[model samples]
Target chain A: MTVKELRETVKSLLTEGKVDLVIGWGKGTMPGTSTPVFIDTAEKADSLIFDSTCRNNLSVYFTKDRRALAKDDKKIGVLVKGCDSRSLVLNITEKQIDREKVTIIGVPCNGVVDMKKVVGKVDGKEILEFTDDSKKVTVKGREFELTFPLDEVISDSCLTCVRRDAVEYDLFIGEAREPGSDENAYAEVEEFEKLDSEERWERMKQEYSACIRCYACRNVCPSCYCNVCFVDQNDPQWIGKSPEITDTMIFHIIRNLHVAGRCVECGACERACPMDIKLLLLNRKVAKEVRDRFGSITGTGLENKPAMADFKEDENQDFIMG
Target chain B: MIRIEKERIDEFIRALMETWSVYAPARDGKNTLFAPVEDPAGIDHGIFNTDKSPKEIFFPHSEVLFEFEGGEIKKVERDARPIAVWGLRGCDARSLRLLDKVFGSAWQKPDNDMFEDPYWKEKYDDSIIFGTACNEPRSTCFCNWFGAGPHDGAGMDVKVVDTGEAFILDPVSEKGKKYIGSLKGWAEATKKDVTKMKAAAKEADKAMGEVFGMDGIQEKMADLFLKPVWNDIGAKCVNCGACAFICSTCHCFDVQDEGKKGKKGKRIRIWDTCMFPIFTMEASGHNPRDMSKDRLRQRFMHKFSYFINNYDEHLCTGCGRCVIVCPVNLDIREVVREVMACEA
Candidate 1:
């Protein structure tokens, strides 16, 4: 299998002293789940596995300070899916980690199954095994076998994925496909646009009301690595700590604005949310606006500057008030 | 004991709603959560447990203590609505007992001068908890280690056993007995129904294997504060607070004053987690637990050691929500086993 071959490659890198650790996905305690694995030795590489369940962006670990890895200044190898590679590209451009200090093992992804959707569809059955071929997902439970078309169980971000090929990589594991068409990328936003301002505000209020302020969305996003988040600041106290409706709304708006031109639409924020708040709507709306106004697509290439970072004198001013 | 027919469950809920604000495990989008429900049909039937624990009913995510205007403080009135929380699992119900110690549930003015969480006491005082027995526990459930089981009743007033066609409701306290006796349309449980409930409870116990023992874990944790096991255990943690928010027993909170235009303001209390970097930040910017390793150590240490010293019981209830919702899959059971294996 391609995953096994990839494991062997990572194992060799560790044994050869090329990389101190290979960050990848490991078998989770439950079926249809995968956890981030940090393998520092060739013997530990056998636990690594890559499949549709490998939804985590392992590049986030590379950006964090590592005492052991930094003690000897050894190179770190990280496994990146299609969407996760974008974070690596952004990190390289931002100089969060030197490109020379990391080895990227890029893997072609066929989209991952959304755990929320699977849990909903399984109808309280203990999923024994889950296999996905991009087009369909087969779930085997105690006494029943069920198959769901990819459109039903696939993550929302995967469905609207425009970039499926690895843009930057040290080695490509599977067959690389060109960036697929995302004609319906903003279909949900378009439908949301049909609503009036009052309707939109009401919808946002209802969604934000359920937020418990766990900050999982911020912690999971690869771009949000501020040492002191605005929400955590006490001097100015920009946002309230309470879960008030208005406070929650402002928190989401400010957080989305912070990552405006940088969000890669990986759906990590929405997936990480315990309340199932449909947070991607806010991120995608900002993404769509940035795309239409500035003609900037984030993480597309390292050479391309961030939309909010670089500005032209002749920037569009049609929406500016007189 | 009273028996409620499967079809008349709604009738019981509707009757309770007339007297109290009834909350039940109901469908919220795709996940089941404890929400206020008017119709009994809205209650989730097949779900094992709510995604969010019923603890939120007593201890809300945010609550206003008082409002201040022009330096004059005005205390907010507590809601007098007596709440009825239905469909709580035994693990979740037991967690309330642990939280009671932290929130000063035993405090009285003459007896103890310690601060009392009136907000929690107000909601939890007149509240009635209906605990449901888990016949088919999830693989993530490990309550057997914390002196709790799938069918163990610790803080619940009533114990409910789902018998496929009907429910055998057994009162666990005087309040439960009084409440069940006052309710109408519920028949008295028979000998056959009692036997079925016992069998179900026995099956639940067997399903939850006692694979990991916590016999000396609390004492071991007390001595392993300076050990290297914490460094290894905290390595992969992303420092996300999902584990704390989902935990049934975690009860740390932060209070803040929110004012607008410098005229009127309100002081509110919200949930906080020890996993955050700023949870222990001093006003002088001196943080003792600045590193993620220290924060991770505090989380595990407080649950196993500090709480034991204060309350004589471990703070953790072993509901396994932390094991399930963790993004990086850091299992508390594994962490405890490592602590137990640590050489003192």
Candidate 2:
């Protein structure tokens, strides 16, 4: 949808007292980025924008530490792309948020740009200005100007995203397109699986060793809403606080398992990670397993129970019995 | 002053590495950070500012204070040689000095070594800091806000300026002077080179533009401690430690004990931040900074008010790492402006 329509819709929601707050994306201080903006008044609704740089999953506000945003009978209006919508649905199914209190305004996303990929494309030049026309992204630096196909710099998750439109929304701003082809959804995972076990372990170690234990990945994740995360539980701490390879690996593995059937594949964790760890590789692998084993796609339906949450008598038990 | 050709910069780094364990900005996977330089060719001098700050060179993310085995405590050993950092920006150089006040000496009692941190002292006390002039400061850079510029040589042994074809290294400290005197095959910096260096510094300072007036920020922060401005300023914060972790001057850390069973363990200190809710949680389940806004307020207050109250300087160096990495884009620059504009 056009940004004008999105703003008008949010304005009406606040003006009509339908929602107390509208959470959306605003222009970020940095080029090729957007920040989550909380709009509470009709006048503030104009700050909302939906573009490739709008990478944050605004649904994260509905859970855990941010639950106060929806407290006191306040109806919250949230802008959701496909992944964000799934996160909201997951939150609702997990009983973390009341669906009644949220007004989901779905924006049909083409995809979000990965700023790291863009920077890499420009050979690490400082991007001063960034503009995208959906088909192409143009970045200008002090000495160079470059334009590239949108697909080239789009987030890795977006390349494999089966759903690019919200499955559940109170008001969808754009026309809902059919789900994207899933033929190449697990292509990267399949390639990763082809590697020998030792090679995979080495790759995992190399990737996670770079982690500074900042917890940006965990903090940005909507699915990771535990009041006291396992990593923070000092009473019987599961892993060392240090970014030791073993501890970092265990943290990632446990977190991956924790969100196995619930992960929305939003790519927020990977994007938020300052270390630029390839977090989605393992997450998508677990997601693929969930999809294959239980025929479950997370957050696609309100009535569906998470694969890990639901138990069936006749479901596949080959792993347990074979 | 000493001069080294731009193409032979690696040889200079290699020379420094012979005596000191050199740390420089280098490519580590997708990010550039300060890493140990065994091969001088691996050092990347072209980066504007590293993705992660050079603070990790002195104060690592995690440091084992001591290891214990059946009541016998063993201190972690380090290389006898001191450290030498290459290509640190002015902001990071200043950050180290700011941290040194806390770690190098007891601020309240200048003569007392009782409050000094041994681990930080061991690494940083004798370290030679090579402050590089940031000729092309990024848009987010605001070192000028804190009475600093891209070329401010506040905490450097040697001030290194890239004058296109060669580096003009000016000795700023006694150690730097002696070190430069010892180095061989380095030419004396000519008048033209000094002029180029000065011109570059001028252009970079001009590029930094206007400095935010921080005249009464400390007082304003104290006055607005219990005000609603914090709620507005912290509305979009995700309560992540990204900003604190990436910051050059954020020095808070938490110590934890790890063991195999209860027989043996090592006490380790890891980086911590007030951005986390648990950072201020009490044993009795009472948290002074329970809300995200409260934790967020503490970060700003400590940076602007409490640190200034203690050390007569703001804790922030305005390196702008937080400005770039914030997922929600709660820009600290805008927050500072908002705080300044707010009425108590």
Candidate 3:
């Protein structure tokens, strides 16, 4: 949606006091990415715009502010994409947010390019305007023409998304678009899998070897909801925070295992990592395997039990038992 | 109980693998682990025990309860089925029964539904463990502490004792009865199969190590708060939670808020340990276990005392992974022995 269109909707919602706050995105203090903003008034509503860097899921606020709600009165208006709305459905299943309490304004996302990726390509150049129509993106007054491929560039989830249309929403801001054909969602994992078992172990060891345990990945995951993490429990420390490879190994493996069938694959943890780690590869591996085995994808058929929650008569773990 | 020749073991396992996820000790070079295998033939039968337990398949190291995101709360979704741990030992299998008592019952403190974890339900719901006799017991193996041995089928779905040509499948649970019926290749029990299996158990019994025989571990723990020994023992202990990570029974954890500003990101449950100095620290910056000594005392007391009070079972499974993994080599058995020796 256009900047003016987004602002008008926010203003309309605020004027009616239909919501306590209109959550949106704005430019960040960082060089490329934008930060999340909670627009409670009409004056600030004008700044709410949909941009390429406005990539992080804004739906997280519904969960963060849940404790602040008293007996009544909580109507949150969210602007979401097809992929983002699927999380809303999964969120409903998880009861992270009340479905009736949310008012969703669905945006038909073509795809959003990560500013970090563009910035990395341009060697720290500034982006002036990332025209959605122009596959040709202008940066630092230089025109770079390119076609958007669903696999290599757009949100990785669109590759495997069963809900290319809005899963749960009150209104559609635009007509929905079909997700591109099945992408090689597991190509990276496939590459890792093709190696000898020992090589895969070494690869995992190498990847997790750099973990400093700041928990940026865990803190940023949309599905990683817990009030008391095992890492923080002292009475029986489940896993240590030691920076050593073995502790780090258990941490990374257990982290992935815990979220095996639950991860929404929003790329939040991978994006939030300061260490430039590919945490998504691990999480996506679980998603890929779950999909391959169950022939069911998360966030689709929102009413269906999560992959791990309910089992079909024929549960496939042939890979596991073999 | 049923009997099948040792050479026919692979066929029996393969048949079990059709309906069950066979988790057994498998090796990929140096790292030996208990993993689910479709082809039970690949596992080296000589490997007696796994470095890791089958506990994670039943009671995960970490798991999410539910997520609160974007002013919305999404409950964690899980649907579970049955998994069969093929080579689980007597000690670890018994530990699961203990864990089931804690998580399966409806006494949740803070109200997290991970108590009904889908992964746990799927694998453990109708679990049919096929335990094998530990022919070569490790120095660390101490199933005897809990009134068990290499051939003890206390909690196994089925116990297999190698009778030269065939394995005598001694069914320990109702689940084991159905598992044996499905095996067509196994010969009906001959007295010969039963006798050899018994002979193997008798042979293993001769080598069983002395049990710790420690008592008053729970009785003395109430007075541990007054004890001055926490300092000396906790000094050697680093706050790394590795011991809990490798433990067969430690089940503590915390949740994380991960996501965008408006969206509640992933609410994740991850492995946590009490060994960290700030574990007992409140967010307001007041730490209950201000010094490491208080933290150290809490760990021992909880394992031996508080858990017993609540569940009528000691938390430790006596797996000894903690002893080998502890950087300082602080053995938990030593801790138990020392606590028993200390004056009340």
Candidate 3 Cα RMSD (Å): 22.9
What fraction of the native alpha-carbon contacts across the interface, defined at 8 angstroms, is recovered by model 1? 0.46
Ranking by DockQ: 2, 1, 3
Compared with the true structure, what per-residue lDDT tens digits does model 1 show for residues A1-322? 3768988999899988999888899887777788888798888999998878888877667544442352357788888877888887776777676778788888878787787788679776767688777578888876889988867887898888878667778887876777865556899999899999999999998888878788888877887877788888987677777777887888899999988988888887787777888899989999999888888878778887778887777777678843
- Judged by whole-model lDDT over C-alpha atoms, candidate 3 comes out at 0.65
**Clash list (residue pairs), candidate 1:** none
- The prediction achieving the highest DockQ against the true structure is 2
Winner on DockQ between 1 and 3 is 1
Compose the digit string of candidate 2's lDDT tens values, residues B1-344. Answer: 99999898988888888889999889888788999998988887888789999888888898889998986889888788999999999999989998998888626474554478889989998899998989999899999999989988888999999999998999998989999998889899999999999999999988895898989899999999999888788888889899999999999999988886556988989899998877988888888988888988999998999999988999998899999998888899999999999988
Give per-model TM-scores.
0.93, 0.97, 0.51
The better candidate by TM-score, 1 or 2, is 2
Top candidate on lDDT is: 2
Q: Pick the candidate with the highest TM-score.
A: 2
Clash-forming residue pairs, model 2: none
- What lDDT score goes with residue A203 in model 1? 92
Docking class for candidate 1: medium
Query: lDDT scores for all predictions?
Result: 0.81, 0.89, 0.65
Candidate 1, which segments miss by more than 4 Å at Cα?
A64-72, A133-135, A181-184, A312-322, B106-115, B181-186, B260-263, B342-344
